[model samples]
Target: MKYKNPVISGFHPDPSICKVGENFFLVTSSFEYFPGIPIFQSKNLVNWEQIGHVLTREAQLPLKREHSFIPSQGIFAPTIRYHKGRFYVITTNITIRKTFYVWAEHPEGPWSDPIFIDGFRGYDPSLFFDDNDKVYITGASFPGAGPEGIFQAELDIDSGKMISESQFVWEGTGGSSPEGPHLYKINDWYYLLVAEGGTEYGHMVTIARSRKPYGPFESNPHNPILSNRSTKLPIQATGHADLIQASDGTWWAVFLGFRPVKSTKVHHLGRETNLAAVEWSEEGWPVIGENGRAKVEHDAKLLLVNEPTPWLERDDFNCESLATVWNFYRNPLESSWSLTEQQGFLTLYGQSCTLNDLESPTFVGRRQQHFNCEVSTLMEFSPTEEGEEAGLTVFMNENYHYDIAKMIQKGQTIILFRCRVGSLWKVVKEILYDEPSVVLKIKATDTSFTFSYATPTGEEKVIGSGETSLLSTQIAGGFTGLYFGLYATGNGKCSTAPAHFDYFQYVPGQE
Candidate 1:
């Protein structure tokens, strides 16, 4: 059985995992998406289902709806661990400059509110439970003094506080940015695994070992024991890894990597989740795959379920609340949208922020997981003011997104197509319409996004097409992937009008 790469797809990145009983649980970085820190459960490492989010309520998260977020801010990296019958997740919020942890009796749960670790600094936090039951926390950071390396301190899990002075453990294999530290006491040797080099082509996993928890450690002779940095494998930036041993005594590593668009080096889908098999060398070193490079296919015997879900592209909106797949840009103000009020439709009340504003602008979206795909939605909207409008968006971030909306231009209702990249903002296409409702569509082929609108008669025509490469991380300069979202805004002033979305559908394809 050959397990395919990207056991998890789309923008899910910075994966961390832990095992309990016969099950494995994982968590990933959310980075500005509300209901942050997606938690997943898997009986086998290959197939997973999102059980819930760690930060559900705003009181614990506090990413204000009206606030603007820069790229790669908000939630950074999360590490999950199960100890003494409790599940713990530790991570950082860059925008708030804080580190916190949440724990539950079970992997899926009504998790306890965040316990902020006072004076905890840096990012990519992890937890390690020693055999003696002494708990420790480590993170990537450069403090004011001492050599820069992974830092660690004894932690009081119950109080969410650091109990001991921090110390620098390992500097990694001298990679550009050594981060994502996970420590394990395996066979009496403390093994320290850290991802280094930047997160692109040079990303790699390096290891070190110390007899004591605090190390003047020895770097693995085969230093970067795992990486695809020098390979032609479809998975690139292979690092940021966590290890878990199964009840059967098998070892596996879960890491983050990206699947670039076919033949192109650019990837807009963002870093995704990948897995690899690990083996111990006679010298006690952990070797990844047969040749020390992450493999695209692993032995079928390792995974109980090797099937990955085909892209889920359609949502009916008839449910009482938004499904787990849909995510908001920031903390969504609960009063601005609803599903029960209209029944079978999502009504988004127009807010003051435009699509270009970092503040929440009555928008909700899902990841664009495929290069060749089509996303469309039926929207019923009536714009009474010039700046008031609502429709669909291909969003990368505040400054880099494409908007195809319905707006009022000089008292006439029309379909509008606008392009925004950095400081460039211009309406690329417009079409006048006599009707107040229309179905808007965006067909994303390998190279471009083709915008279209359909009439009541069910006929459709292309309104405009734009280069898809414009949304790539190389051009957009963000740590997030693309999201297809429904949006309504008044530019700056709030509008009373609402945009009713009949449904949103995404059809995956290839060319």
Candidate 2:
């Protein structure tokens, strides 16, 4: 049996997994995107479903990143654990500089309000439950130590506060950025797994062990048991992993990795979740997928559990609320969008903001998982003001985005293609239109994206095409990937009406 490298695809990065009964639950980092920390559930490692988001409300994740953190600067990384009867998610809000913990009785939950882990500072927090029922939190930071390093502390789960002084535990395999630490007691020794070498080209997974939960940790002889930096593997930057024991007692790991565009170093879809098989050596060390290079396909069981389905690719705007897959850039204005107000349509009220502004503009998007795909939406928008515009976008961040909008010009509304890279903003193409309602579409490949709109006679004509590589992290310089969805804005002036989206669809191309 063979399974693909990225068992979970797209911008769902920084994966952390824990088992509960016969099910495996996982979570990933969601920087600056509201409804943060997506949660997934699986019966077998090969198939996963987005069960829900941990932070579902703006109050839970109040990202004031406009003046400080940008699109990819808010949430750092998260670690999930199952202990007692509750499931815990520990994460750091880089924008606010606070490490917090949230828990729920069920994986899909009304999770508890965050309790700041006071006195504990820094990022990539993880929880460890020892055999004695004691819990520990590990993070990449100094604990009043001689230098910045991975630290550990006993935690009171109920208060979400440290009960013991934090101590510097493992110094890593000397890889840069020693972070995303998780602790587990395998046999008689407790194992510490941490990702180092940063989160890019040199990213890797290293392990250390100690007799106790906190100290005398020795780095594994074969440190960095997983990584692709030294290989020609297409799955680059494979690290930040979490381990789980399946029902059959097979050990597996779930981590984040990116698949670059063919013949190019550019990967715009961002770091995605990849699954791998783990084998424990006789010396009590875990050896990862074939010399730390995972194959594109794998299967742990000769008997597969459930057949998998492609990620969500379409929405008819017929639901009561937004689907679990949709996300806003940051804190969207509370009253700006609705699904039920127009019945069978998603109405996005034009906000007084543009895509370039750090402020939250009216936008709702999904991750661009595949490079070659077709995304289209039927939008009925009548912009009454010059600055008001509504359409689709292949967005990276505020500074780097491309928009195909039906905007008000002079007094008439016209379909236009707006491209912005850093400080440059230009209208690449436009077509005069008497109708406000039009079907906007974007056909994208590894190299470029073609923006088009449907004519009155139902003919879809290309309005503009731009280099897709520009949105890559290598070019845009962000920790995020491509997000294609609907956008409506007024450029600081509010609109008189809302933009109505009847349906949205994305059809992935063949591999």
Residue-wise lDDT of candidate 2 within 99-123, one digit each (tens)? 8989999989999898899988768
lDDT of 1 by residue, 1-511 (tens): 7787787788999999998887889999998898899999899998989988888887767765343445667788899998888899899887787899998997768889889998767789899999998999998884553566798999988897788999888888788888899999999999999999988989999999999999888999887887888778878889899988987788888999887766568888889988888899888889766566876777856567745766567887989878887888888877678898788889998788877776777899998877789999999888888778898999998888888999877889899899998889889989988687799999997678999999656799888878777888878886888899998887778878888898999998863
Evaluate model 2: give its TM-score. 0.97
Q: Which stretches of candidate 1 lie over 4 Å from their true place?
A: 65-70, 142-146, 309-311
Residue pairs in clash, model 2: 2-298, 3-297, 3-298
Full-model lDDT, candidate 2? 0.86
Reference-based TM-score, model 1: 0.96
How much is the lDDT of residue 229 in candidate 1? 85
RMSD list, candidates in order: 1.8, 1.7
Clashing pairs in 1: 1-300
